[model samples]
Target: MEFDLSWPVLWNGLFWPLIRLTFFISVGLLVGNLIESLQWTRYAAKLADPLARRARLGDISAASFTMAFFSGITANTMLSEAHEKGEISDRELILSNLFNSLPTYFLHLPTIFFIAAPFIGSAAAVYVGLTAFAAIIRTMAIVFSGKFLLPPIKEGCLPCRLDEMEKKRDTKSALQKTWARFKKRLPKVLYLTCPIYTLFFVFKQIGMFAWLQGFMSGSASFFTFLPPEALGIVVFHMAAEFTAGLAAAGAMISDTSLTQTQVILALMLGNVLSSPMRAFRHQFPYYAGIFRPRMAFKLILYNQVTRGLTIALVGTAYALLMT
Candidate 1:
């Protein structure tokens, strides 16, 4: 058996996508860190205070919600400390952590949007918007759960001292921190991205994607709503990092056969399917380090299940409206 490889095809597949994504990732991370360093997201917590009150989240949980916009670990740390001190019950801790989902999503929104836009173009807007919507849904669900499952709290929920944190912001410091973070993060992102893009390119050249689509045709009933090429996107999303899925989507976006709606829907579907495994792999250690191992697993399970269902519901609505 012989294999034919062309430099021009490989170059087009790999070079352009890598360069574009790298540029976007770098700019996105720098700007994102800068914005975060400026402490602008503190306002999110303020706006959420009313909801927090309605849900009867106490001072520590409210403070942690504010802190989550800056550092999830720090916010979670606060909850863990409170749990240790017996300031809050186990149910309240879990519910409060779940309620922070919106702030956490917004904290990462800039980076996610910028990184996605370069590859998926306008579809990024639709996809990110849907995910944002799903985050809102999850947060609302948590709020309702807290209201029903937990007892009412005292009248006073100590306001977060975000203003104190905001007063310390310095543009020079923000820039320096952004630069340092960009330097540390960009290389690692590219390290994963380059190899994945190259491998995806090779898979494309070998007609593996087509074969996989055909092979999975028997199972296509499950995804009758999506085109066969969409299986490639979902597979890449589940098997590799998000960039791999974006690379696959980027490659397919140019193909005249696939409509923009189909591509967007595919990305949404991939997100719904991939989030569980991704959350488990990435969030387990962080959660476990802060909470007990069993609690960490429970948190991960709940987060993924909530995220998946919300995204699936939102995606279904989108598919119905668009298609």
Candidate 2:
């Protein structure tokens, strides 16, 4: 078997994706660090105060809600510690945790958008936007529930002067920090991105996607709502990781076989359907460790259900609008 390694295949498959993604990641890290250094993360904590107050949670949760955007486990740890110490009631604990959903989305939006644009291009914006919308809905729902269920309190539920909050104001200058963040994030980006795109390219070269496309051809009839060519994207999205799904969708998009709405909806469906299992696998055990098992089960279950419904409803509406 003489190897058929050719320049076209190598350039298209490996070099281009790597270079594009690396450039995007570099720019993304720069923007991400700049945004963080500007006190946006701390600002998020201050903004969450009203919601936390409405939820009747301790001021501590305001801090936790802000942290959730940048680091979920850290936020959860703070909330869990408050619960353990009898500072917040069960309802407050759950509601406050739920309220952090929006913050978490905002926390990572810069990174997601910057990297997504280069690979998925503009369509990446739609999917990320939909998810962000869902997070907003989830936060709103939590707010309404908190306002209606919890009684009004007089004391300041807001934490002390947020101005004093550790700004993570590193000693390094902005340029140094941006360079450091870019360096720190590159490995993770490459790890997640390079292998997936390369493998998909190999699969393309070997006709695996073609075979799967044929096998999955009935998508026009089955999915009905989406373009037929989107079958590969849906299959890869559901069967493999999200980047794989995005890779497949991006290919179809470049060829103009699938519309942006179809790509968004397909990825949305994958996200909704995959969310529960993902929550069980990742959140349940983690939550159990933080809270007691029973409480953890309840918290994770609520989070999963709220998230799934939000995504499904928003995605369905978008799909219908597209149709």
Candidate 3:
């Protein structure tokens, strides 16, 4: 069947993607800034003493991982800033960020399941539960490993000293500070949103996504001998944002011959594979400015390696348990 390419249909497809992206990006900016001001700053201050070096390392690692797992884009920016300020060394910063990315896999599962429930019926519950369980397990693994995984801090480097000239800000005024930060982030949110919306619409109108999905399908078939639906999902995932990839996966869930476990595995794999591309498209420039290109590359590579190993191990265990 020839798909309709009418203006109305195009507009309909573009509407949700645009709205969702803008809303999430805006929320990410506001909430992210507030999180930084309150929680992050306090954490930094609490661990600023020389005696708390080990504790500081763990806190930094956990926080970086939490942010990455929950929200990669915002978390990555925060990590870069943290590294620049020397709160953490380049190596530690990268390891923490990478470790956190794995947990992010399960972070969005609840929302994704709720959104998919209407279409997939009861099976949505199973998918959501399994994915959430996987994420929790991964989080635990990282936490346990964090005790030994992080390298020792350099001797004589006083715990990220706050200069005497830099007076502490009033933490009690959180609401006001949050509002101010939100206002400041408004322009940046719009800056990213406008281009993202425009590109999303233009791609939809040109049928670019379909062609890209087709290419993915072909590749998946060639490599994994999987059917079109699985391949299409993996492809959409690689080529587009998470929401777009999930939407494509949802569309094919009922029609595909793959088992539930297979579908979930495919989706998870797609999420992992898409990370580097997503980082390159959105984060590289920001990080490049703070750290030299070589430093940025090393940081990202370290992150990917750590995250990849964590995910592979955790994903294998999850698959084994489910099977």
Candidate 4:
């Protein structure tokens, strides 16, 4: 098939999404990082006290995860920086992130359910209930795992003398330090966010959505038992970005005969499965700067594995509950 390949369509579809993505990601990174840094610096010294640092790390990690649960991009960036700065260890960082991912998925619970409830009519309760149950159970798993199974630090892991001195000589106030760090990181964050935006726009412009829909529709026949939209979402999830998967699910739910539960499941699975790839796109660079490529890869691998297992378990539970 000969494509139009016109400039106007390209700009409208590709350029716009790209621009919007860049703007949102940039704003998220800047504001999120600044707030996190302020909180960290303000409490770091106090928490880092000889009597408090260890306990503080746990609390901070939990708080970070909670923030991330609500919003992934910003919180993940902040927590990764914290990990690099020795505020938290590798295990704690990974566990915190994994724990946060499920909550983040449910952050839109009220909105999603509210929207789906009217559309699905009475069946909405089963859909929402199953999804909520799954999220809660997954969160509990992360919490229990973090509390008992997470590794303990080796003796003298915290820099007692250095921490004390740093706490004593806090020259710049928390707000000042936060602003300084924000300024320093702003350029890099924009540079990264801009390209992602551009790419998103380009993908949209090139009729990628149409192609994805056709391909997924064809494949849906093979997985006839599962909801076509859900299967389609999983397929698009593997090939494209999370937004693509979400868009596909939204379109399918509106047009196709998919249940609300199926749509939510697809969206959740698409999001969870696509995380490793997304992290590679955004987080790998920051991580690589702090550690070698190999080390960064290992860290990402650890994160993906932990996150995947948690998501899978939750998804399974949701599916079972739905049945």
What do the candidate models score in CA lDDT, each in turn?
0.72, 0.68, 0.58, 0.58
In Å, residue 298's CA in model 3 sits off its true spot by 4.7
Residues 74-110 of candidate 4: C-alpha lDDT, one tens digit per residue: 6566666677678777767666665555567577777
Top model number, TM-score: 1
lDDT of 2 by residue, 1-323 (tens): 23346998688766876686556545544554554444343455576676667666556667777777766655765666557668678988888888888887798888877766765788888888989999999988987788777667557424443555554655467667657755764565456556655665666577664555445433434676666666567667655667777888888778888778877887887676555655664355345544566887788788889998999899988877876
Q: RMSD for each model, in Å, please?
A: 9.6, 10.2, 7.2, 6.7
User: Which candidate should be chosen as best, given lDDT against the real structure?
Assistant: 1
Q: Could you tell me the lDDT of residue 92 within candidate 1?
A: 90
Error of 3 at 38 (Å): 6.9
How much is 82 displaced in model 4, in angstroms? 1.0
lDDT, residue 49, candidate 3: 30
Quick one: ranking by TM-score, best first?
Answer: 1, 2, 4, 3
Candidate 4 to truth, TM: 0.60
Instruction: Encode model 3's per-residue lDDT on 1-323: one tens digit a residue.
Output: 35566777756765555566566656665655666666564344343233234433544454555565567656655665466567777656755554554556666666787776765566567656655565555445545554576666555443333243156656768667777866765566556456655665566466765565455445555536345667766776676666666667666666766666666666666755666545543444434433456776676666555555655565567678877
TM-score per model over all chains: 0.67, 0.64, 0.54, 0.60
TM-score of 2: 0.64
Clashes of 4: 3
lDDT, model 3, position 42? 39
**Number of colliding residue pairs in each model:** 0, 0, 2, 3
